[model samples]
Target: MIIRVRDQFDAYSTNTNKVLEAGIDLKTRLFSEGGDSPYANIIAVNSKRVNDPAIVALVKALKTDKTKKFIKEKYKGAVIPAK
Candidate 1:
C-alpha cells in the first residue's frame, strides 16, 4: 500500500516507524493540489493542514497498535501499489 504523507512536516517523524514496524513499506509523498490517487491506502496529513475528514479518519485509524500491525502484515515487504 502507498502511504502518502500530506506534507513535509508529517513525513519527517518517527510516525513512519510505527507503520514500518507493522510490515508495510511506506512511501512518503507530498500532497499536491491536484493530486489524488486510489493506490494510496492512507494519506497522513498534518493536523495543521486543512481539516479534511479523510485525513482525520486516517489519523484515527493509525492510532491503534492493532491497525498498525494489520497494515504491516498486509503489506509486509510488498511493493507499494502504483499511483
Candidate 2:
C-alpha cells in the first residue's frame, strides 16, 4: 500500500528486493502515465547555453533510440518516454 511516483520505487536506494520480500506488490498499475494524472519530467536548459555545442549534443543524444532503450531497460516500466 505504498503510493508514490513510479520512478521513486525504481531507484537504486529503494531496496526493491526487500520490499518485494516483504510482500509488497510492484506490478500493480494504479495510474497510467497520461490517462488522468498527466505529468512531465523536464530538463531546463539555460537560455544562453541553448546553442552551446555540448548542450546541442546532449539534447540530440536524449532524442535518440539508444537513449529510449536505455531508459526502458534501466527504469523498466517506471519511467515512460513521451513520443
Candidate 3:
C-alpha cells in the first residue's frame, strides 16, 4: 500500500516503509545539517580572491567562541562546525 502525504511525516512516523530517517522515538535527529556527515552544508565562493587574506580572516573569525556559541544556541544542536 502507498499513501502520499505532504512532506516527510509518513517517513518520520513510520506509517510507511521503515526507510524513514527517524528512530524509535518521535524526536530524533539522525542526520542534521552539520552533525557528523561528510556531505553537509557547504560554504563556497567562486572568486579570484578565494585564497586572499580576507578569506583567511573570515575563516578565522568563524572559529571564535562567540560564533561557536551562537551557532549552538541558534541551531540547537542542528548544526555543528567543522573541526
Best by lDDT: 2
Q: Candidate 3: what lDDT?
A: 0.53
Query: Is 1 or 3 the stronger prediction by lDDT?
Result: 3
Put down candidate 1 lDDT per residue, 10-38, tens digits, no spaces.
34334334556554445542332122434
lDDT of each: 0.49, 0.61, 0.53
Over 4 Å off in model 1, which ranges? 1-49, 77-83
lDDT of 2 at 11: 37
lDDT, candidate 2, at 19: 48
My TM-score estimates for the predictions, one after another, are 0.28, 0.54, 0.48
Pairs with backbone N, CA or C atoms under 3 Å apart (clashes), candidate 2: none
The best candidate by TM-score is 2
Root-mean-square deviation of candidate 1: 14.6
Off by over 4 Å in 3: 1-34
- Please provide, for model 3 over 1-83, each residue's C-alpha lDDT reduced to its tens digit, 9 standing for 90 to 100: 22234254634322312323232332353533334566544457778878988887887888888888887786455456555
Q: Candidate 1 overall Cα lDDT vs. reference?
A: 0.49
In candidate 2, stretches whose alpha carbon ends up further than 4 angstroms from where it belongs are 1-25, 28-32, 35-38
Q: Rank the candidates by lDDT, best first.
A: 2, 3, 1
Lowest summed lDDT window (length 10), candidate 1: 29-38
Give the per-residue lDDT of model 2 (tens digit) for 7-27. 567533344434444544656
